[model samples]
Target: MTRSPIITVSRGRFSSTATQVLEQVRTARLASRDEIAAATGLSIATVGRTAALLVERGLLRERPDLARPGVTGRPGVPVEIDADGYLVIGVHIGRRIATVALGDLTGRVLASTTVRRPLGADPDLVQLSREAATLLGSCPGRVPLAAGLVAPWREIDLLPREREAELHDLTGLPARTGDHISAVAAAEFLHRRQGRSEAGGLTLYLYARDTFGWSVAVDRGVQTDVTRAASLTHFPTGADVPCSCGRTGCLAAAVDVLPDAARARILGATAGSVRDMLSPDQVVLVGQAFTGDPALRDVIVEAYAASTALADPVPVSFTRFGSDIQAISACTVALGPVLDDPLACVELTGVAAACRRPVA
Candidate 1:
């Protein structure tokens, strides 16, 4: 068994053997005190006192069936975290809509609402942010401690920072956005969950809406915690299809379907689009393109096929969970914090060798 090494918890908040045990039992699901002590390299007495204090804080619990008699060769008790401790908000800002979901530490959606809005930071961006932020305004009697906002794919680099503070400030619930990709997180999380091991298959996620992103993960029979991926919307994939990015022939350059003019009318594109990118196997495609139109789905597949890089790998196909993947992806990112330990309850694992291949 791969023994999870005990590590320090809350570096400045509460640093001790107890805090370590608290974090582990709550997240890793270690069953007993001996298990905790062995993992921490701490003495049994310290483990006991620390556990007692945690029980008083409503942070830990002991299993009755696992409880043992006094030196009678009986089964011992197992302890775990009491999960009903806090609340968190997972906000997914999509091109056309924003989904806000309230969850516990275990990823349970206490309440959720999906709202649609215009795009960009001007009046639209401000409205989107204001509406997205309102989900937290109506607290569901739970602790309104933190909210995680997952903007559309390209905005990953737009999160305010030291220098970017001049860009704009996002307030309410210690929120900050960065280069964290939802496709990447979902892929890795799935690889760990279903594969039964650390390394196995690959996971490919394509956000196939107004704005798009792609991610791939591979495990050479070993589960991968890291991935090689990109959110590729910087330029047009084809030469003539219009895009929302205010350019022609960017991603809007090709058409296996209608004429570029016709596609532009339907796609509401800013550039001429062509089939440029291809996804690896078990590729999970999100958005209405797949569900609403069969021909559009075929076009997506064929467009992928036309590209040597995207078509050659022969990956399995997966679909997005909700209407907007960003919503669930946002859930995946934000919900992790609410649970005592997310891995125990949620099946965030995936198959082996997810997206590994020689890009054709």
Candidate 2:
């Protein structure tokens, strides 16, 4: 909302040596400089310097307590994300409800609450901002760095720069907005990086609920440049349901086309068709359409399996976060700046003072 340089990192345009080191430590949860160097192809000296910078900025912590007992050097000391040092606010404006959450550096949700939205009403920035502030206030000692707002693309017109500015004005924090689908894809990307580096390939993320869309992540980054998810709402699903477009079988219209089993089959078949067209290396299913009912989920899975064209099955999985994906995705966007450039974020957000306060 403030158009700060730090907030623009959500656009997927920035990365640095510090980001590389921080990301390695985050992925491993704990890694020595040498381990980071090995994983990132950076020199040990570079890793040490970068790790030191990150530690000084409060994005990482030196874990001498976890050092190898018999070893006695910097390489013996591991560093991990300093999860307690700061917080970010995540606001997800959905069709019927808005969720506000406080998240730690490690993408853990600290606190969250939902505010219901009246049918067909525009989101109330003032109300959502108050909710976000309340969440942040609940965490006594935590310093909030930024806020991220996400909504359906159709809703994007309603949340122009003015809306973002309103949220920033109300909450006293820099705020940025992003497409909900892409944010969810980024969250999934971060989740995959937890224990190991993601294998190199294209990943297709399919989402459904009050809206329908898909997003793509190429290796480590979500494809933010592509913003055509809203167009998928009109994809033909071959069902005889009426659409606002004066056509039948549109994906959005097919959602309520018939019996639960038929709906599941149509959704699954639609997903498979998209997957085949993209030929992605993997597929991840998310949103209430996929998670709300077990029977529907099973039917969709069967239909998807039958629709694939490849001899070798592409790996398909459901989001582990389930209904919590919305909040987590928004948090991931808010955390983007820090993850992209830790030292810059500290300076930009004036978080340096908070970093100096001793941790309890």
Candidate 3:
């Protein structure tokens, strides 16, 4: 089945009242409209209207059954995210494997399947889309609104937009594409937001594995414009390691940190450089380079501490997701539209035609 071209959701758009109410309800899991209004600093009337609209769109559901027994007003009824009502597809095209996953409205990965690709081969969009459709079919009652695709390496022959179009056409779902690193950062940010209150400031995310890269997140949003050339691969670490680009001491050349002190030093120096440049409130270390070996992680940490110029030390921590980072990041990209603008996403996905349809 053919699908309309998916319009890119503007990540730079300011949060709306509906978005605020939805986010408040999502974070609270279940909350009264009054609670949402209070948390979001929105008027009660605005919160009520936004909540009602979200409920109508199937993004949220009112739980009158859980209403306070003594209360006789709308304030007694609580609203919660309708996680089972919708699903989004997340496709991560890694260097060695391509993963397709199903995510709920709450960014939970419901199911996933991975396919291995030959070394340095272009991904088969048709095959990947078929796999995604199969996974979607396996979930009997969920309405899939959109798909998010992420890749570690960009193919010059096929742009990300073209790939998104192909996936959308094949799967009949709106699709968005982005760099895997940025998606990973976004996933981390969203995860932190969901878990606890985030400290106010910038977060610098460092990724090391087959490639070296970094992303910055301001408050609740991640910078999504990371390019391969802009990666930390070219960052000088003052090491003697040779890089494919005819450079010495490139970060990419130090990926093989199998207890090699030199490579570890390179990684540490790069992290320190990032620390000094951004002076982020927090630094998140992710990917196999840091998680694969404890010794390497220690070296990087030590180097980062020694390299920092700030009077106060910045907090540095490893990602809790570890190897599952890629999948979660892709899912975050898919759920972006719904979370950013639920009402618009519901309308764009034609929720009335499918979201409300009964499961067979």
Candidate 4:
């Protein structure tokens, strides 16, 4: 049976007090230092220090009204995660357009801008570099200090160290883009942000919008070898599907065949056609096609039924997410810095967790 993933983000593997505090804040939507201490067993001192640091990082905010009673202990300002204070930039690079988004730390997008740059003719890197720069430069929010980018990368036998550096440089945050922040090195970040352990299944995360991207997480954390388990761009229908690589029939090759393009106003036709093809149990369609267009939902439902007719049906139904598959895919690569195996993380974090989960 397939498994659908549930995402819950917390500072990974925190101490007992921190975990308790996080749960309170996540559920109650507001917390104060003393309140946190009273509710979670964290000492007021530790809570104060941690809360201060998180606030400095823009992860939380102070809520002054929910004051503590002074008779019992000291009164302190209330605190809540600054859901609106900071943002994560998600850039979806595709053959036809690019997507730039400003998301709060919780991964909720507050504002976004999409630019269409006909990319089939440009050198993929030069074009991608320009797009990444453009998105970071133009997106609107609280004047972001750091940018998180997602883009598709060219497939290779081996990737160079310089390529990694170039990606960081593209963000225009040169000093901040080094080892700790680069995609390949931040597995812990993505792993923690992705929150897939409880999903209990083997999954494939296809980052196929601006670029071909992916990540996989199973019941196990980083300790096992899920690399061998991921199928990259095409899983069940690899060479069999028509794709841009000039392959007669590749999984995404038929993306251009959607009939409802005009109605959906989606970037292109691939998404609609794919919807006509397979329907995983839980799909998380990102970008314009899925996010902005509603009729496309029907197209996806029909496509899903058609997908089942194949000789070997995908084992489970799926939820949906993806619009600029290529951009999401590329982000998967930029995302590689964080994973031991970038593709594996895609499987775990993306939709596969909702499709077929590994038995715990």
Which prediction has the highest TM-score against the true structure?
2
Q: What would the per-residue lDDT of candidate 1 be over residues 28-146, giving only the tens digit for each residue?
A: 45457776676556777787777765555444566666555562221145677654544555566565566667655433456577776666532244454465456656654344334
The Cα error of candidate 2 at residue 297, in Å, is 2.6
Q: Candidate 4 residues 29-135, lDDT tens each?
A: 66667766775566788877666655554445666656665623323777675665333344544356655554443434555556776655432444555554555
Model 2 misses residue 284 by how many Å?
A: 0.5
Residue pairs clashing, model 2: 1-175
In Å, residue 85's CA in model 1 sits off its true spot by 2.8
Q: lDDT: which is higher, 1 or 2?
A: 2
For candidate 1, which ten residues in a row score worst on lDDT? 3-12
The order by descending lDDT is 2, 3, 1, 4
Among these predictions, the greatest lDDT belongs to 2
Task: Supply candidate 4's per-residue lDDT for 62.
Answer: 68
Model 3 scores what on Cα lDDT?
A: 0.74
Alpha-carbon shift of residue 14 in model 1 (angstroms): 18
- Residue 298 alpha-carbon offset, candidate 4, angstroms: 5.4
| TM-score leaderboard ranking | 2, 3, 1, 4
- Model 3, span 204-269: residue lDDT tens: 888887667887766633112222223787787766778788988777765553246666666776
